[model samples]
Target: MKIAFYGSSLVSSYWNGAATYYRGLLRDLAARGHDVTFYEPDAFDRQQHRDIEPPDWARSVVYPATEEGLARVLAEARHADAVVKASGVGVFDTELLEGVIRNGASHAIRIFWDVDAAATLDEMRGQPDHPLRATLKQLDLVFTYGGGDPVVEAYRGFGARRCVPIYNALDPATHHPVAPEPRFSADLSFLGNRLPDREARVEEFFLRPAASLPDRSFLIGGNGWQWKELPANVRHLGHVGTAEHNAFNCTPLAVLNVARDSMADIGFSPATRVFEAAGAAACLITDAWEGIELFLKPDEEVLVARDGQDVAEHLRALTPARANEIGEAALARVLAEHTYTLRGAQVDAILAEEVGQMRSVA
Candidate 1:
């Protein structure tokens, strides 16, 4: 199958958390014998801070952030078997969504891959005339990163023909245990962009915990955190790249996963960090969220914390041997059920079924 995907940057993790998710899924699709071309807007300063070159597995096209560029990409998309326009493309998203749905109406299978399902759904619920809501019925299929049942049902209510979650999964080849790096070595580490939705959670779950344990070292790796005042024990390493994730994960005695408010309320949405940290054999401590056990068992495979006190207590009680056991268990669980290979196969089956159903109707 020939697939065309337009989303946030694929080669840079700078301010774009979806980079890992896109790289993992699209690389697996290409590996499974599909011709996949990724179309990313050249805005967002992603190219300026690129962490990786385009991979050989799939074609990566960066288009200008202009009307002319959208025209060219829409033309290119029309020829593919399936054309997907993902949320958070950083520019002209509504225009891009409409263009893909309009141009791919007859030939290509049109898909809206919402990486931030909770936020998208929230917007749609609050605004009656959200552009995406106007075109919900036109999409052939919808895919989400997380938000299991509630998200699916919400999309259905908005007239999405079909909605499925292609949850975040680990790419073992990209994220695995590595020798610990002295630079990133810390008692606790967290890697996430400081966004409005997630900043408060980071404060509650990561910064507060670090403050309570002043003697312990805590490291943060991501962009947009320079202005915030942090605890003395917490060190900030702005903009950790994709290549550094494995080492970053391995260097920490334990890694923290703090979901944004929208994701936490919706439940069942495990961010990509959870899988990446687990894949690197990092002892995981995460904020309480619904459906986390569906990914990793709490207290056994992962440690769950409701507040700063919980995180501090967990950190204080963690022994080297116990941390290793938890990390190993989490790693085993992700490798078994949360690898990109399995996700690729699921995507293949879903598309095939959709195609078959289309044929039957014809």
Candidate 2:
């Protein structure tokens, strides 16, 4: 099958959190003998700070961030078996949603891959006439980044024909245990962009813990954190590239996973960091969220924390032997169940089923 995927950025993880997910899924799709073409807007300064080169597995097309560019991409998409437009394209999202439905209605299997399902649903609820809500029924399938039951129910409530949750998974080839880097070595490390939705959680889960453990070293690797004042014990490394994620994770004694407000409320939505850290064999400590056990068992595969005190206690009690055991357990779990190869097979099944249903109707 020939597939055209429109996402925010595939070549850079600068401010885009979906880069790893896209790379893994698309690469696996190509490996499965499906032709895949990725269309990404050339805005967002991603090209300026590109961390990875375009892979040969799939065709990567960078288009102008303009109407003409959209028209060209839409034309190409109409010729494909399936065309997917993800949320957070960072440019003319509503226009892209409406245009894809309008232009590819007959030729292509339209899909809205919502990387941020909770946030998208929140917006749809607030704005009844949001483009996604208006075009819900037009899409052949809706795929999400791990929103469990509530997210699927919400999309179904919005009249979507079919909804599937494609949770984030690790790409063992990309993320694995690497030698620690002195620059990123710390007792605890977190890598996430400073977005409005995540700032408060980062403060409560990360900063507060850092403050409580003044003697312990905490490192942060992300962009947009320079404006905020960090504690003395917490070191900030701005804009760590995707290639450095393994080293960053392995350098930390334990890594933290703090979900955004909507993700926390919706449950089961594990961010890319959770999988990456685990893949790098780092002891994982995460805030409480529903459906977490679906991915990793708490206190066995990972440590669950409710507040700063909980995080601090875990950090304090962690021994080298115990931390190694937890890290190994988490890595084993992710490698077995949460890799892109498995996710690609799931996607292949879903798309094949959709095509079969279409043929039956025809």
Candidate 3:
């Protein structure tokens, strides 16, 4: 299959989960013999901030990140077997969105691959910008990264023919645990880019706990957090790249998983970090999320902590040996159910079924 992905910047994946998701998925696709071309705007200073490059597996094309960029994408998309318009490209205009909607109908099965379903829906509900409503009504398929149930329902209610959840999965080779390093090794660590909505949760779940457990070294990694207050025992390591993520996860006695607003609320919608932590065989201490038991068995595969005190207890009571046991169990569970291999297979099956139905109609 020849697939063309029109998405936000893939060059700099520093604070971009969507790009990371695309990279992992496309790499898997390319490995399976599919020719994949990822298109991104040249804006966002992607050339200067690039964290990843084409790795013999797939091709990458950088456009202007403007309406003009979409024209180039559409021209290239004319040749693709399928074209995906992922949400959060951050450079969309009505001309581009509708061009794919109305004009590029022949070879392009324009898909709405939403990386952040909840956030995107929030945008759609309030402002009605980007001419997305019109584009969505014409979308061949809509794919969501998170938003377990409510998101799918919303998409359909909003007039999509099909809505499928393509949940995040761990690329095992990149995220597994490693030998300890003094610099990154800590009692507990949390890594995520800070956003305003999540800042309060971070304060409650991470900072307070670190303050209480002064003896335990707590570490935080990510960008957009320059303003956040930190306790004395907590270490702030800015923007951890994909390569450093494993070292960051493995070096910790336990890694913490913090979900953004919607995933926490919607339940069962685990982020890629959840699987990354598990793949590292790191026992996880996660904030209370709706459907956590579906991924890691509470108190067995992972420990849940809501308030500051709960986090302290987990840190105090969970010995390194116990942590190792929990980590192993979590890894086992995820390896059996949530690797990218499984996700790719699921994607293939879904696309095949959808394509078959389309062919029948044609």
Candidate 4:
């Protein structure tokens, strides 16, 4: 199948969190003999900070962030067997969402893949005329980043024909165990681009914990934290590229996963960092959220913290041997049950079935 995906940057993880999700899922689909062309707009200095080149697995098209540029891409999308308009393209999103369906081949399966379903749903609730609300009914299927039953029901309520949660999974080839590097060495570390929904949580879950444990080394790696004051024991490394993520994960005593306000509240939504940390065999300490057990068992495969105090306590009680045990157990579970190979197969089957049904109707 030839699939055209309109999404955030695949070549850059700069300010875009969905980069790995696009690479892992689309790379797997390509490995299964499907052709994928990922269309990303050149915006927010992402092109200037690309972590990867155009990969062999998928054709990467970087278009100018202009109406003319969008038109050219829409023309190219018409030939795909499946046209996916992912949420949060960061430029002309409504045009792409409606354009893929309007310009695509009649036989092509139109999909709206939401990388942030929780936030999108919130927007729709606040605004009755949300563009996606009308587009939902026209889309053949809605694929969420990862919000189990609640997201499915919400999209269905908004008039989606079908909705599925494609949870984040490890791309073992891209992310795995690596030798620890001294530069990233820390008692606990968190890597995520600083954003509004995440700022308060990062303060409570990461910064607060760092302050409580004055003796422990802490690190923050991501963009937009240049001016924020930090505790004496904490280090801020601005914008660690994707190439260094494994080292960042491996060198920390235990990596932290702090969900955005919406994702934590929505539950069942695991960010790409969760799997990336697990794949690198890093003991993970995630802020408390519902449905965590569905991915990694709390207190065994991962450490769950209800607040900064819990995080501090976990750190105080953690031993090197215990961290290794949790890391290995988490790695084993993800390798067996949550790799992209399995996810790709699931999506492949769904595409085939959906296409076959379209053909039958014709």
lDDT of each: 0.92, 0.92, 0.79, 0.94
lDDT per residue as tens, model 3, 320-359: 8999999999999988988888878877777778778778
Ten contiguous residues minimizing lDDT sum, candidate 3 = 96-105
TM-score of 1: 0.99
TM-scores, each model vs. reference: 0.99, 0.98, 0.94, 0.99
Could you tell me which residue pairs clash in candidate 2? none
Q: What TM-score does candidate 4 reach?
A: 0.99
* Candidate 2: 10-residue stretch with minimal lDDT: 99-108
The residue pairs that clash in candidate 1, if any, are none
Q: What is the lDDT for 324 in model 1?
A: 91
* True lDDT of residue 345, candidate 3: 80
lDDT of 3: 0.79
Candidate 3's C-alpha runs over 4 A off are: 93-96, 103-107, 128-130
Better of 2 and 4 by lDDT: 4
Model 1, C-alpha of 353: deviation from truth (Å):
0.6
RMSD of each: 0.9, 0.9, 1.8, 0.7
lDDT by residue (tens digit), candidate 2, 1-362 = 88988889889998999999999999999999999999999997999999888889989999999999988887887778888889999998988888777767474689999999999999999997788888989899999998998999999999999999999999999999999889988999999999999999999999999999899999987889999999999899999998999999887789999999999999989999999989998999999999999999999899999988899999999987888899999999999999999999999999889889888888
Error of model 2, residue 7, in angstroms:
0.8
